[model samples]
Target: MTYKGNQTTWDKLSPSLQQKIDTDLSGIRQTVTNNKTEVTEHLAKIATTENLGHIKPDGKTIKVDPATGIASAVASTSYYVEARQTAGTTTYDVNIPDVTAYKPGLTILLKLLENNKQGAASLNINGMGVKSFIFQTYAAAVQNAGELQGGRVYQLVYDGLYFTVIGVQWVSSYEGGTDLANNPYILPSYGAVGKVDAKVAALQTQVDSKSTKDVYTINIPLISGWQGLAQITREDNNMLTLYLDIYGGTRTGGTKIGTIPAGYRPVQTYSMYFGVVTTASGSVSPQGAVISIYGSGDIYITSSNIQHNIFIASSFK
Candidate 1:
């Protein structure tokens, strides 16, 4: 039996063979129909004058400019790229599909990973022509040790001629000891540097207290960063023993030096002299006398005798 165009010798074929041919042709017809639809869709897409992304041979989507006929691989809107380290220095290589196709005002996001070293990292944008980018740590120029640490994310914008970093997320963990006090590039938000300033400010306080008959007491406010330095001076009074207590203690001897109290033995004591003065008894009194003490926690001052004016100067760190 001879086969003709679009017609097989069906009458001469066996029933089983004819059934097989029918099933095969049915599958071919369905395949052709599906292919036709796909071709039509592709042709329609090509004919449209709009900027549509097309799949490239490499399975990447390439954006096509309808008016300019320029094509470029579409960059990710928000992407994360890690930095590589060589010889203790971190670096990155940003490869753009087409530099010319990257329009101004376009932004890209990158998350950079760094090593525990004290050196500057670099980002090289290949094929960027004369364009350049400056990366910063905490809004300051990234130079010297500890500026570029692990876990940093930055947002870069292309401004037609160059790329500029517009945003940053700096991790608090610093390598190379680049703290707020040491590294000028590290801002208060980066590490514990902000607390250092508060600690320094809380180091000193001045207060005035008076003792009337036997003992005098003054309340020293509690400070978080208090270190403990107390300078106490007697403004007026006769020659008598002065007892100091940070917590609270009883005085025993008339000329006994102050004690740190039963529960406050950790407080350190220091003796300071003010000057000599004449007592009401017509005798040359002890020179201007002052006592300096250092410790932590609350301060409580006690002295002997009434009408004794006392000035207390304290510090912390």
Candidate 2:
């Protein structure tokens, strides 16, 4: 018989039933208090623990200082092994306690301190089960036990099968952008502008040299780009044919510059003839012209001299 809110109903209940209800209430109160005390004890242990060994998501255990609530992973052990070939120590074997202890993404940095040895030194990584480890000074395609140089820092990471080289320090060169202060690499400056200026200067010099013209003798080859006048005098001629071979001018055989007949020879004494030669025209073939006289004429053709004057232009077409 449970107790009701009404005092009349409670009074109607048997004393034995009422005593049972009171006993049940006392047990519930004690259980609640015990649960609160257990919770407080667990919280206190969490707050007081100096080193909280918590497993990280990567399966590595991190130690947390409960007083500061700062969590930190265990640092990798650095081995500064001295390898000198002069001392007959060509290879240094690194002994890792357990190969299975290494997980993927685990990194270890090792420094190889050389002792000014005469020959090269190498490192042999041991204790990693069937897995092979490759060490190199720079990134390479092949895997091998690389030669160890003095004062070089190498970073190695395990990929569950092989310990691959991911980074290196004290290298001679780097491929990508790096800090200019300590790195040996240099950035290239703009050089195309300087090259263009040099080319333009050379072209200007050529143009300047092409602007002068000079006179030449027609008997010799004519110049490439000039036109000149020549005077030919024939004092005595018996169907004389004079070849006017300009340097770069042309004319047909029938093209006559002057003609003298036998009847007018002694009477005239001398006959003057003038002709023009130019290297600028495209109609001229074979780059020359001929002056001839034919008429059964005994005439003296003379003009200052047999060789005529020709001028050559400075500029080329």
- Tell me the TM-score of each prediction against the true structure: 0.28, 0.27
Error of 2 at 227 (Å): 52
- Best prediction by lDDT: 1
Question: Per-residue CA lDDT of candidate 1, range 1-317, in tens?
Answer: 22354445557778887788778888889999999998876665453446566766654556656544443225335444555444544445666554335566566665655544544444555644433454534433343245444577767676665556664344553435445577777555444555656666665321123334333333333222222333232222421223332322222112222333332232354443433534446566554444444343223322222123333443222
List the candidate 2 regions with Cα displacement exceeding 4 Å: 1-91, 98-102, 115-123, 127-148, 169-317
Q: Ten consecutive residues with minimal summed lDDT in candidate 2?
A: 308-317
In candidate 2 the C-alpha lDDT for residue 172 amounts to 35
Tens-place lDDT per residue, model 2, 77-104, is 4333333232454444566544336566
User: Distance from true position, residue 299, model 1, in Å?
Assistant: 42
